[model samples]
Target: MKNKLFLSLALFFCATNIMLSQNIEIKDDKVLVDGKEILKYEKINFFQHSFYSLTDDEEILMYKYNDNESREYKEDDYFILNFLTAKKKIECGDIQKVVTGLGMSSKKNMEKLITWLLKEKVIDVNGILNTNKLDTFYEKYNENITERTIR
Candidate 1:
């Protein structure tokens, strides 16, 4: 009986460790699954008990996983743009709207995306409009924002 109880407890602990080891990866400003980069913004469903509203009066919990190694900001910029363009293609929404909805509403986030796009040649700087001009472009091209080829 003692041996059986110990085995059961060991199994339970092993199972718990395996479950907890499945952590969400945030690397190179991109999320990964099994080391493959995930390029689109994926919606996650939370349990009701785990869901907490974030309003002005409420403090929201944010997690940042730093790898403790310095990476070139330019390389990060390219990856970010590639990720955003891929996400934009997969999801029919303005980049800003999609990112903001995904809890990346800060100016820094926006800048990173924009800079990445420019660096990657996804959006030509010469023809690129200012941030203020993006609204009009968004409105005009909103209909074309559906899932399409990311050219």
Candidate 2:
């Protein structure tokens, strides 16, 4: 009887460990794996000219925006919910791609991500891709220009 109880307990513990290891509960700015947060550090991508960002434990999280949404890892608007949980900023290209997707995104969502891109200097006040030159004829005549000296 003692041996059988011990064996059952061991099996239960092993099962629990396996289950826990397979689940990751990602919150807004924290990553929880098996109820324990992974070790993380700040990273400043100089090549891309980005500010300090948080990352996962030695892993670059590439979230899928293919629209196969699930409650476990749902899309929290423009930025990947998972990456936000890791406290990392999304690239402009990534944001644009997800933004243009068929998923129904809120106005505030578009404004937030677009505002972030503009703030980060990722995209200028123009079209999507920077490869094309914008025709400034409209801007040269259409836009109202005024000079007001600051006190």
Candidate 3:
């Protein structure tokens, strides 16, 4: 009876560990896996650029770039803006690609991202990002973003 009880307890612990390992949670700006931090979401606004980013234990995974000179929209700006905007359904693969595209930072990309935000009235021309748009976006698709991060 003693041996059987010990074995059952061991199996129960193992099963709990396995289940916990697959659990992902987002609280505030952090993403937790099995209750341990795996990544964090951050926003940066400089004199020349402003953008959102994701950082892992090692390096930045979000698009970060600089371009303070031109006041015009370029091609790169359009691409960056399109990637971040949730105008259409954001698929898992699409997010994966964006996350992987490090150094996607450029003046153009920032411009485009900001431009889209401005166009959608998501943000203002003064470079202030409206959190409501982000909050809404996250509410709708945070699961997909968190899932992609784990992968």
Candidate 4:
């Protein structure tokens, strides 16, 4: 009975890890998944200074993942979401940090987030998530004030 329990537990862990695993890479100012570009970036020049403009969405995603009070997803999950939904450019390595209980968020809060997105029509009922729809959803709901909005 004990051996059966241990085997079951091992299989569960392996399956969970497989489900959450993602290959995240940044190349040539683009965020890539499995060598396919998922996001692109353009360098910003400010007179003598030049830098990339990071998006509010990117920052908030990291905040939600790193803040102990709100931390409920793995970095990879946050990374993909940010890449898909952010209107502004982001550097993948900018917010990387040591995370405890890395995959702990996979089951609960992650599911809740997905469910809410689906209900809001941000995500479709299809098995595969549509990245363009994700972007549209973020743009529709994001609350960052812009100069155009002020007028």
Candidate 5:
């Protein structure tokens, strides 16, 4: 009976560790994995590491517009605007300007718009803004202009 109980407890601990490893939370500029806040030194390094891992060239290609399909840039514009507003916590006004600068006019064409920007060399892989920055909003609430998307 004691051996069975010990085995059950070990299994429970292993399952708990697996669950804790998958999700990350941000609050007050601190990163939490499971319930514990990661140390400051680890936080920045971890963020940088994750950021580098997420952004890649192929992901950028997926958002490009295909003119042969008659896709409009507006669709992409609105998509980007909404994404930026939600992810960066930026004002709608600011997002509009950024979207316009990218030649995107509609939310529906966001995919194509982003692709065009990348193809035109207007926005490089590192230059394109990332919407996932919203994940860190609870911590810093600061807008990051340099964030890029990851596939």
Candidate 6:
């Protein structure tokens, strides 16, 4: 019984480490997955949730196990570690932090850019999430904000 317990515990740690090693990492103004450049992302606030009447949706969906299908946020490290993990999405100046963290240039305010993108219909009211439009937008404009490194 003791040997079985020890083996089980060891397996658990190894499994957890493997899972965490694949968690999203942002470095040098790029989002990396398994050491490759992946789509840029932003933590979002779907509602105000500040007053008694405000409602906020802080959760997001991400790829599950390298498959196209995604479930709701569950043990997703991206959401779990950010302040958006709070009962409501972050507010005010802090929201900017999320944008900057996602490789957005601080010089460019998201509200104005997002408004223009929405006006152009590059993104919808739901926000410019993990879609190809966002990927293309980043591909086109990211060079202006972040210095490209020759590989």
Q: What's the candidate order when arranged by decreasing lDDT? A: 3, 4, 6, 2, 5, 1
Q: Candidate 1 has which clashing residue pairs, if any?
A: none
**Which regions of candidate 6 deviate over 4 angstroms?**
40-151
- Residue pairs with clashing backbones, model 4: none
Q: Model 3, range 57-98, lDDT digits (tens) per residue?
A: 332224433232334733222112223433432222223322
Best candidate, TM-score: 4
**Residue-level error in angstroms, candidate 6, position 110:** 16
Q: Against the unseen true structure, what C-alpha lDDT does each candidate score?
A: 0.33, 0.34, 0.40, 0.38, 0.33, 0.34
Off-target runs (Cα >4 Å) in candidate 4 are: 43-132, 135-151
Error of 4 at 117 (Å): 12
4 or 5, which is superior by TM-score?
A: 4
lDDT by residue for model 2 (8-114), tens: 99999999987744333333333333454432222222111111123324433333222223335534222232233233322222345325344543332333433
Alpha-carbon TM-score of each model against the true structure: 0.22, 0.22, 0.29, 0.32, 0.18, 0.25
Residue 124 miss distance in model 1 (angstroms):
33
Better of 2 and 5 by TM-score: 2
- Residue lDDT tens for model 5, 1-151: 9999999999999999877443333344333434454311112231011111123322221111112222454332212122222333321212333233444433323323333333444333434443343343223332332254232
Candidate 2: list runs displaced more than 4 Å: 1-69, 72-105, 128-151
Count clashing residue pairs per candidate.
0, 0, 2, 0, 19, 0
Candidate no. 4 TM-score: 0.32
What is the Å distance of residue 66 in model 2 from its true position?
A: 5.6
lDDT of 4 by residue, 19-112 (tens): 8554444346543444554333332321011112233212212213322223564332222234333444222222222122435332233334
